[model samples]
Target: MENRKAIEAGQDITMQKEDFAALWKTIHLKVTDTYEVPPEILWVNGSTIGTLGNFSASTGKAKSKKTFNISAIVAAALKNDEVLKYSAYLPPNKRKILYVDTEQSKYHCHKVMERILRLAGLPTDKDRDDFVFIVLREQTPDKRKQIIGYMLENMPDVGLLIIDGIRDLMYDINSPSESTDLINLLMRWSSGYNLHIHTVLHLNKGDDNTRGHIGTELNNKAETVLQITKSQQDGNISEVKAMHIRDREFDPFAFRINDNALPEIVDGYVFQQPKQDRNFPLTELTEQQHRKALENGFGKQVVQGYSNVIAALKQGYASIGYERGRNVLVSLNKFLVNKRMIVKEGKGYRYNPDFHY
Candidate 1:
């Protein structure tokens, strides 16, 4: 009877639902040691420092400016600590910034480091000791999990977590559900550990959506979303547009990267301003202009079959009997999204002549 009572007591302790709930809640609301809002030296001023709790992925078209280049901006800030004082009146406290470069090589980062340091007029040599770089290739799920676990365990002091090209870490970008799961995992890690997370992602060729299911979810969940687009004037220059896309607290702003060897944020110059056409447009514009003009005419002609289709949805529209909407849109490149365009919530679609023009 005594032995049986002891066994029953042990079972009761193990089955305590309330105790498990409390433990779960504690992990969910994990907080760092310091209670103050950790300062994330942002690339743009007044930019809402994105949530460190979830993955904030930046996506842009191919040959468009890279969102990850902002990493260089941070490195520049760390190198030229004085610049930090301009933004925040107080002297900048040197904190450990960790970069997990899943895309670029150490050699590549070094080149970028040289250009950034030289432009900032800071000692380039100092970066070797100040920054910690972990280079990982296209890692499998198990491998990525292992790497992340190791990072959390070994580098607890990391103030910023930059994951260059999140696609390299996941197998699929088109699966929003799957992507969300991966993002949630990363978010859990970031939140659990209380670290700022920045992930680099590639924009679908003709759309803002990233490559997979998780890509869209990542973008939607991020505290902030920044898009890098090529400068229409100078192909060499890339424009960075940032918005508190998800976070209500953020304000939107735009800036351009200059032609300097090392790129830094310049006066928020309005690229929309009219400027002289330094290069002859006639030669470069002939083929593209003609093709786009034709497409524009077709798009404006009114998509007959998709009359009742969802305005925001660029593809997979059906008109009950019209089984060829996707096919027609693809062939015309008119109904389907050729490039990101302005479309109203319920107006079906609008052809931005300026973009296609």
Candidate 2:
């Protein structure tokens, strides 16, 4: 009643200055005294995609298997399994995954689900309440956003969310303001929920870049951006390259649909052959050679310096130049370090042979 009387008198309709300060003090922190260990919350192709509250994107041309790649990621996250020969963050309590497909018919989407289940090694007949798949081809732009917003708000356990057709969420991909707004919403949702969000985008038909202003904005804001492209050497193979990454980027890897119609990495696959010239940098070696060196180095199971590792690589292939060999050795060492296949020692590193590729 007293508060009502004060309001009726038209004195200070807004919150009082002292009350606002009290509310601010509840959440304020001392900058120098505050410290926190970053969360380990992202994984793709066995590499750390990023920490929590980060967004990543995958882009490809039509029929480039962009959806399939993301499906593999979803499978890994849900089953706490590996995908494309890479490990993922497997929480003690498996968290729910929400996959929203804005394009594709119901029939095609079901096939995607089957492929994901197969990759996760889960039976198709089993009940999967933890993984939710929503096909929203008919939903309006506004409606789709509303539904996604509701899910994010109500389902606190959803640790991973994949939007297959992220471009459809905005009415105009060419509009800078619209694209900025959509990305802002995604960034806000990701940070607010402490979740990782992956979105799929289509690349320009004639160019390697993603389509329109929206793609540009997404690339700018995303912590990791993967590019999927049909191999020029073979039509059956699709190459996935980490175009931009905040952390260490893995070498480009290729996959093809197996007899089971699932995406599987081709072991010993070489995306491209290096130019046959002594002048060519060792860094330009084929993906196969890189993997071979990495496997050989890790096979030793002993602490090895970079020079010794390069010597071992040259033993497998005599064509590697001294500088080129060192480059390859360093690259593979970084990759293995990031993948947790090896640990750095005093002026050397020890490889873990038991670590699965």
Candidate 3:
């Protein structure tokens, strides 16, 4: 005890401000002239600046379209070199993909990868060698460390770190204390190494909140945040909205899911009614006739995301995102824009004068 006390007192654990300044200067000099710090590969073209430096968040209920879209963008950045010239995009290229699959099946993942790669126009290659899969069948803390450390050493140049579900990666997802430590650990390693990390998290039931304490930290630290929702018509189609929620200077955009490719922007929605004319027969026409003869068309059941489309433009203003209860407005193509008895104002169209309320 006497020796320990003496040793503790003699230890110089505390550093002076001058020491830190000297260390910072030395590091800065090394970084400035020789060392190159790679930038975060933006999944969306021209979205990197708008998305800030990081993207991390929880999607609203029934939304995954955002995830799909972002993933596609990542794939494109990794495989297509041409996209980088115009957009601040980073494609992993030949760099390896580190996939930590907790809940997703191998089959599902394969399909998603195939579609994304094909869309990016990647040639066929060996899946086993290209991407490394770390399934959570019986993952232990020690095992995780071993895997991560080995990969970092053996394939230190890896570009992407994809963990399917955040909860499964940790032994205790409920413990805020423990989760905080884990988040710090990852952040330290990622910042030190400049690796891009992407993970999936489950949202609370009936709430927009994400699951567990770890999720909160992840959402706070991530450079990008996206929410995904499926279309009502078939639930097969999904919509993903990407937002720089964590970064203040960035804007958000929405993308629709693709069956074969990464999701793309789905122009917008239209409101139309059948056109009625005094010269036509007075008798009420059949459903088909009513739809065609009258300029006003019956409101179609928003198949998948038709409602969100409405919600996107509820503000009646042409802009991006919600501004004072004014939802983001997206204009449909000329053929799809609602034209039945609706007022038109520089991209802002309302019901036409002849149409009844």
lDDT, candidates in the order shown: 0.53, 0.74, 0.49
- Give the poorly placed runs of model 3, Cα more than 4 Å off: 1-40, 43-45, 49-67, 81-88, 91-94, 125-130, 231-237, 243-264, 269-357
Q: Which segments of candidate 1 are over 4 A away from where they belong?
A: 1-19, 22-24, 27-43, 51-54, 76-94, 116-121, 126-129, 243-260, 265-268, 273-357
Ranking by lDDT: 2, 1, 3
lDDT of 2 by residue, 46-144 (tens): 467755577889999998878878877877776676778545673544288889999989999898988898889889887687888999999999999
TM-score of 1: 0.61
What is the lDDT, from 0 to 100, of the residue 108 in candidate 3?
A: 69
Per-candidate TM equals 0.61, 0.69, 0.56
Report the number of the highest-lDDT candidate: 2
Candidate 2 ranges beyond 4 A from true positions? 1-30, 33-35, 44-46, 90-94, 273-357
Please give the lDDT score at residue 86 for candidate 1.
16
* RMSD of each candidate relative to the true structure: 12.5, 14.0, 16.0
Candidate 1, run of 10 with poorest lDDT: 82-91
- Taking the tens digit of each residue's C-alpha lDDT, what string does model 3 give over 124-208? 4755455566666467754775677577567766666666665665778777777777777666556655566666776677654
For model 1, residues 1-357, the per-residue Cα lDDT tens digits are: 999999999987784778788888665654554465644444345444443444465667886757335545455445534232112111233345666767666788676556645644667666454457677765675586679668777766665667776776766666546666677777787787666677777777865555656654664466666677777766766666552243233333334445655454545545674332333232243434434543533455334334433331223222211223333434334322323232221223444444422
Of the two candidates 1 and 3, the one with more favorable lDDT, higher being better, is 1
User: What is the C-alpha RMSD, rounded to one decimal, of candidate 2?
Assistant: 14.0
